[model samples]
Target: MAVTVLSVNAQQRGNRENMTPEKMAERMTEKMTEDLKLDEAQKQEVYDLNLESANKRTEMMAKEQTDKKAARENMKADQEAHEAKLKEILTNDQFVKWEEIQKEQREKMKDRRGGGGRPQ
Candidate 1:
């Protein structure tokens, strides 16, 4: 659910930096709906899952982390769980496509940021 819009539509948002969790979830869900051909129920499920995940991430980001490695591990674990739920919701082809999209987006982010992004 909280796929990070993977940075809130960097191209169109332009100078803007920070979007509320709800907005981020909406945008992420919209992208999934378009790319994955999600039905109404799936969209709602994805939205709720995304909103919940984003809210948790927002809170996690606000806290100070003394160990970045631990934080990254935790994030990875959560993402795995999210992906499991998503797999249950999507068809096999859709899930594969979703992973491809995520990988492509990650590559785009790395290109934009000079290789600054967490590894999966």
Candidate 2:
């Protein structure tokens, strides 16, 4: 039983680590659609945005970067660009709610990482 549980957990972790951009986009779109009550058009737009963002993130992660500081700066720039696009795509209320959701996710991630500082 213990072995089975460990194997299940490992499989789940592997799935998360190997998640594709389309899968990530679909999941994010579904969550946003449910949370924001998005229209079909809005859902489609959000999905496209999410897919693009996920692709960029995957590309960044795949890079062989010797300079951690440079990688961090690049990531920060990418995040800013993504937020700007989201602001344009979402209504004012939706944007506000999205920000709140992002904050909550960040906090949860921090807790999961044992209260580590922001990722470099």
lDDT of 1 by residue, 1-120 (tens): 345674666545753336788988899999999999999999999998899888877777778988888888878888888899989888899899999999999999889878876564
Tens-digit lDDT track of model 2 for 2-51: 99998998999999879999999999999999998898998999999999
Model 1 off-target regions past 4 Å? 1-17, 115-120
lDDT of each prediction vs. the true structure?
A: 0.85, 0.91
* Candidate 1 residue 78 C-alpha distance from true site, Å: 1.2
Model 1 TM-score, 2 decimals:
0.77
Q: Compute each candidate's TM-score over C-alphas.
A: 0.77, 0.85
Per-prediction RMSD in angstroms? 7.1, 2.3
Best by TM-score: 2
lDDT of 1 at 39: 91
* Candidate 2 TM-score over all chains jointly: 0.85
